[model samples]
Target: MDPDVAMWLGSTLLTIGALAVGVTVHLIGLGRVAPTFALGLPGRRLRTDAATFALTHRAATPLTWLAAAIAAVAAVGALAAGLGTGIGEWAVLAVLSAIVLVIGLTLATWRAHTALGDDALLDDSTNGPLRPGAD
Candidate 1:
């Protein structure tokens, strides 16, 4: 493939993968933290399962942050590649799309964490929950 095409393709794939990972992390974090928050009153069992999953997976918060960082980096790389490529406006548009995805993911994660009042439910030691019968 041409160098420009290769750059555009690689950057686009990276951006897309980053966005997917970020979104997945966000959903997992949400499910773990406030599984019942938006589930309404019909899914008691699902809520319990979500809480259990959340407790068991204490790394969700950190993973979310990592995902967001990766997404941001990918977006930047995509933008740079787009500017350097001769693929015309489509490349720039793709870069802009990546930027938008990164921004949206960042904002959503921020809002969720803010609403929860905490990024993670981890204990002081970060080993697990502090209270007994927890996790």
Candidate 2:
């Protein structure tokens, strides 16, 4: 294969991979917290504090949005690179940065999810609205 074609293909694949990773991580993080917002019977609902749930949701929302933005930029860069009009170095840099951001955000979300679950079980009084009849 021609060197230029090889370079373009490699960079494009890298960017696409980064985008996929970011999106997958974001979805998994959101799913982890989804049970907290369930609308099932109070007895069946997951125990969680309202304040902590809100805080975690707030934190995760921004991170997910940021990941999406990074993915979008990387996708665009990849497309441009494939067209032979974009800088290969920039595409590679974008992919690397996106992967780093996604990893960091995933870790943070995991911590928040863990804390939310722990707090709910540890503090009986602050079970939020999920457990309506608990004494």
Candidate 3:
């Protein structure tokens, strides 16, 4: 029955909703561009471009869902708070929003970096191996 709680929940819901929609749109786009990602890299190239793409797709799916869950919980809490008392709710909402946003963004970037690192690369010019794994 707190206004602050309501706002926080609302913000969490809003962030999660935004994240889900963004991810859905991204997946659709990825599917459409599958060919480009599937293309193999030129000489001295080891793995297909699809490797990174696939990795990202896989990572995003679960992460997006996790984020949605968080958002949903926040939304419910916020709604409950709204029905109670309205206090210094704005601050709570702002803080929560910022924290969640940072966490989400950090996770996304970390996934990409991890995937990239996992992708083995080779230097054709030197006929030397860069990172051993894929193509």
User: When superposed on Cα atoms, how far off is each prediction in RMSD?
Assistant: 11.1, 8.8, 8.8
Which lDDT tens digits does candidate 3 get at residues 64-113? 45655565555555545555645345446445645664475466545544
* RMSD of candidate 2 to true structure, Å: 8.8
Full-model lDDT, candidate 3: 0.47
Model 2 misplacement above 4 A: 25-62, 78-95, 110-135
User: Residue 51 of candidate 1: its Cα lDDT?
Assistant: 48
TM-score of each: 0.40, 0.40, 0.50
lDDT of each: 0.51, 0.49, 0.47
Q: Give the worst 10-residue stretch by lDDT in candidate 3.
A: 38-47
Per-residue alpha-carbon lDDT of candidate 2 for residues 5-96, written as tens digits (9 for 90 to 100)? 66566656655665554555444334333433342112221234443443444335555556556665665565565466545665575566
Which scores better on lDDT, 1 or 2? 1
